[model samples]
Target: MSAGPFKVCMLGDFGVGKTSLVSRFVRSTFSDKYMTTVGVKVDSKEVARPGRDPTKLVLWDIAGRNAIDSVSANYLRGASALLIVADGTREASLAAALNLLMQARGLLPNAFAVLAINKFDLLDRWEIAPPTLTQLRRAMTVFETSAAAGSGVEEAFAAIVAGLDP
Candidate 1:
């Protein structure tokens, strides 16, 4: 809305599918091969907001790691929002995602943020217990996404855009 470009950073644990989610949302593609992001891969997609105009989201796919240092501050310099992701099949990644969320909020206190639990296509192997999900939900706006199936990916991105003022 307001017809302006907004930067949104994707922060999460390594192999949590941050790149895949970005690919799916921006390019409508998903790759099975695991590729660790070196620094940040920027991508853009325009999303329409409910009862408002569209906005261009410059998605900053920050390098994922167990710690926030893996993400260069340069990449977060102008971010307007955050998408903190976790691997559903790996419970530990959830912790890392929360850590990244805290770091992002600390750096950009006024920015909107989302907690995404990725790899939903692998539902059979999901290791995140219900209690954890509840806890995560209380912590942030949580989404269960499957980049491989294109489920919830669009909504996740659109939600961030909608959070911006019109």
Candidate 2:
């Protein structure tokens, strides 16, 4: 397959830091201010692969609607990958992320999916259990990320790009 400007949809519940994750990965910047994504926000980043041309990932940061309704499904159209995020401080958000992943898979069966449990910096307040992480690992590549601290941000993006390699 060609090194494409692949469409990667970012899905999660509200306040999961989808925007922050994207900002940190794409622009190497993070902000404390919370801004709800209206409709969808589009951003692009070129990821380097060894011995191949860089892959351009066109990231679609979708609004944090827990359910995949008609409007959300439309925004996810043509996606080749997904970055499903969840707030580590909120266990319910993790469940929501998983559900969103399921819905996204139903829509785009072949799209590469990666799970990111954000806010790793706040480990003290983390609620996700080890067994849960282990279970998730059996399904998809899981990364603990901190958008504020810029941890695992690049690796998560790179892993998705690598997964897209054919």
Candidate 3:
């Protein structure tokens, strides 16, 4: 059976490891250096879930930039879901990611959005407090992940797929 052709967008502030997360998930590779994504890179993968036909996900790894507000409308076209990633090691960017979410909501009001706290491996060095995480939950589905270690990467994608189907 044919399943979606769903379009998923990755959004966040510059240097939040949005590209790294996508690279890890799709390509199974990690890099210590920060390489900015230009425009957008699209990758497709067919995922099989237990009770459903394989779904074709069109993953759009959008570029992270300093001026997220200016490019918000341009990058979110035809998106079925969004993964809003934040660098957990930098607590300040979490708010920036949330603001991006608000902007994204304005653009794609009905699209499914997931709040991913990336770089969990750096938690020991992070300043993010427990209450900040609680505050984040008020907006969307939140997950802690490490692109470097591959923690919660697949599950985050799977959850997004399930949310989209539901």
- Which candidate's TM-score is highest? 2
TM-score (all chains, Cα) for each model: 0.93, 0.98, 0.92
Q: lDDT-based ranking, best first?
A: 2, 1, 3
Clashing pairs in 2: none
* 1-166 per-residue lDDT for model 2 (tens digits): 7579899999999999999999999898999999999999999988899889887999999999788999999999999999999999999999999999999889999999999999999999999987999998998899999999999999999899889995
Best by lDDT: 2
What would you estimate as the lDDT of candidate 2? 0.94
Model 3 score (lDDT) = 0.83
Question: Compared with the true structure, what per-residue lDDT tens digits does model 3 show for residues 55-153?
Answer: 888888888753355565777888889999888888877888888888888889988999889889998987788788898688668899899999989
Worst 10 residues of 3 by lDDT: 65-74
Cα lDDT over the full model 1:
0.85
RMSD of each: 1.6, 0.8, 2.0
How does each model score on lDDT? 0.85, 0.94, 0.83
Residue range 30-103, candidate 1, lDDT tens digits? 99999888878999988876777767899999888766663366678888889889999999998888877777
Q: How many Å off is the CA of 124 in candidate 2?
A: 0.4
